[model samples]
Target: AQRVTQPEKLLSVFKGAPVELKCNYSYSGSPELFWYVQYSRQRLQLLLRHISRESIKGFTADLNKGETSFHLKKPFAQEEDSAMYYCALINGNEKLTFGTGTRLTIIP
Candidate 1:
């Protein structure tokens, strides 16, 4: 079984400050990592994926296999960035596991 862990349940950052949401996973096989975000009254959407290696909405996360971590980062957090962030993993079995999620609040 695969497991995903998000160390923080809530995170507050000042506008223009850097933000990081920690994520760690435990899986035996090579797995895919993804970051998902859900805005107010909106459906959960994909933010970024390890496979794509692209940045979305000024946020980026790198999969660290050695550390078993995929931490979401943004150099300068914007007010719009305040939302629910979830870290997910997909193992070889095609089962997706999601962390409890962290609610990011950008303070002005």
Candidate 2:
């Protein structure tokens, strides 16, 4: 069995501050890691994936297989960036397992 863990349930930061969301996973085999965000009254969308090596909304995450962690980071935080972020993992069976999620609040 695989599981995703997000230790933080809520994160608040002032505008222009850096943001880092912690994510850790446990699985026996290789897994695909991803970060997804959901804004106010909006549907969940993909932020980035380890394999793609791309950055979205100024956010990026790197998969550390040895550490079994994938942490999302942003150089600067903006008000619009406030949202619910979820770290997920795709299992060998193609099933997506998501963490409880973190609510990010960017203050002015």
Q: Can you write out model 1's per-residue Cα lDDT over 1-108, one digit (the tens) per residue?
A: 789999999999999999999999999988899999999999999999999999898888999999999999999999999999999999877777999999999999
lDDT of each: 0.95, 0.95
Query: Residue 20 lDDT in model 2?
Result: 95
Against the hidden reference, what TM-scores do the models get?
A: 0.97, 0.97
List, residue by residue over 1-108, the lDDT tens digit for candidate 2. Answer: 899999999999999999999999999998899999999999999889999999998999999988999999999999999999999999878899999999999999
- What would you estimate as the lDDT of candidate 2? 0.95
Model 2 residue 42 distance off true place after TM-score fit, in angstroms: 0.5
